[model samples]
Target: MTTKPYFLLCFVVGLSNPVDAMYYVQPWMLAVIIPLAGIREGQQLLHELYLLKKKSYAHINYHIGMFGSSALLAFALEFSEFLLVSSTSSLTLSVSGIFKEVVMLYLAVEYNNNQLNTLNIVGLVICLTGIIFHCILKFHALQKEKPVNTDLVVTERLLLRRMESADEWSVDGDSNTRRTSLDD
Candidate 1:
């Protein structure tokens, strides 16, 4: 299956977990994990390591696939959490959920297609269970956290300017209408 969405989900969720706190995760993590995964994936495809036999390779795939899956799951959970913190649900959550679920299901189907070992199957199940709890807890916590209304002053200034502009425009328009009526 196409792995793009899965990776994107993981990237977003992982990033969300911290960014909402105003503490950014180092971009270096992306700078590192992605290239590393790509390199390893390439190595696995091009040259078979003697140490990883046929069975061992399956384990490798399972482990890597599981990690990727977790990343996707975490990304989704983080997004939901971000929404929860906002204390209101809207179109945003719905769309995000749909995207996350579709990719998750796609990866799951691909993982199953590979004739995974029992260990891999078990790992997937366990990880899925953990993800469920993670989403629930994170979202709950987000709802509890208060959003920073730090921009109130700036917002007030902008609103005041807009209101003054609107008043000026309306006064001009009204005066023009009055002048036209008098002439008539």
Candidate 2:
């Protein structure tokens, strides 16, 4: 088979395999992926470290530290994403969530993957629709938006307004304080 078809078949199978493992395997055992991930990341980190050490580039130490920190953060996020995908009941939903994430990354980086065939375009649309629908449903849950309090007046004006008009009226009706200035 061609590479694209093979990749698509493997992707579908990978998505399916996770579903079975998610249901039958213990949650704690799913953590095995983390250490395996660490091994993979560790290899990449070593490569970066080697490059940083060998190159007589400016800010070598800074690059090394940054690479280390980013690898650490990537590890955490990878584990978290795995947990999310495993906990989700539907493989399609989880895959779509990942698809949306990739689209967001593409938008943020302005990188063209250039594999945008009709099917990829259709999948992107479905992923975007799912993400938007999920966001809308979540927003709808908070039918009444809560007021936010902040020290900055100008920036938080909208929040203040929300607070002021939160309910029909205050139950106390803006009563005066019982304590006088002398009480202090």
Candidate 3:
């Protein structure tokens, strides 16, 4: 049977904003979800390993070290992604991911002597334009929502304003604020 339909369903589910928000609210769900996913993936890995007829382990220690490093890196990557999603919206993460891919594509073209046709260039330009627009819209929205501290003293050299504590800044669903002082 074809797996396209299942892949499409998963893609649609992944793009659901409500589901993403729900996951954000209940991040503990990862404890359950990740294990289930790992089990499924581990089964697939075992099947593939079994299919291999000749498997030689000359440098078992080196392979074990590499596997350990790979696991650590994967954990670090997931942790960083969780923190990024917490600090910014999922849309921001998606846009940044696409931009990263575009950069990688360009780097490959430059360093690996990969050729890009007109269509590839056009696609890259469109992706870049969309990312730029998204960034501009997000910046303007943030600027409009940001509370300006009216308590200001205009000096000759510097424009100073009262620094609000993290608690005050984090009100009204703004969890992006970080504690700046020990007093906070």
The per-candidate count of clashes, in order, stands at 1, 0, 0
> What local lDDT does model 2 show for residue 170?
38
- How far out, in Å, is residue 6 in model 2? 43
Q: lDDT of each prediction vs. the true structure?
A: 0.57, 0.57, 0.60
What shift in Å separates residue 13 of candidate 1 from its native position after superposition?
A: 22
Please provide, for model 3 over 141-167, each residue's C-alpha lDDT reduced to its tens digit, 9 standing for 90 to 100. 867886565322222113212342433
- lDDT per residue (tens digit) for residues 69-99 in model 1: 9878777677555545344343345445556
The prediction achieving the highest TM-score against the true structure is: 3
Q: Report the CA-based lDDT of candidate 2 relative to the real structure.
A: 0.57
Looking at model 1, residue 119 earns an lDDT score of 92
Residue-level lDDT tens digits of model 2 in 1-184: 4323432343444433434433444456558877887777988767766887665777676877987998687655544554554443234344556675786668655765545678877887797788777766755654556745532324345555677666434345577444434754
Off by over 4 Å in 2: 1-39, 52-103, 106-120, 139-141, 144-184
Q: Each candidate's root-mean-square deviation in Å?
A: 14.7, 18.2, 15.6
lDDT of 2 at 65: 90
Give the runs in model 1 whose Cα sits over 4 Å from its true position.
Answer: 1-30, 33-112, 145-184
Q: Relative to the unseen true structure, what is the C-alpha lDDT of residue 39 in candidate 2, on a scale of 0 to 100?
A: 79
Give the local distance difference test score of model 3. Answer: 0.60
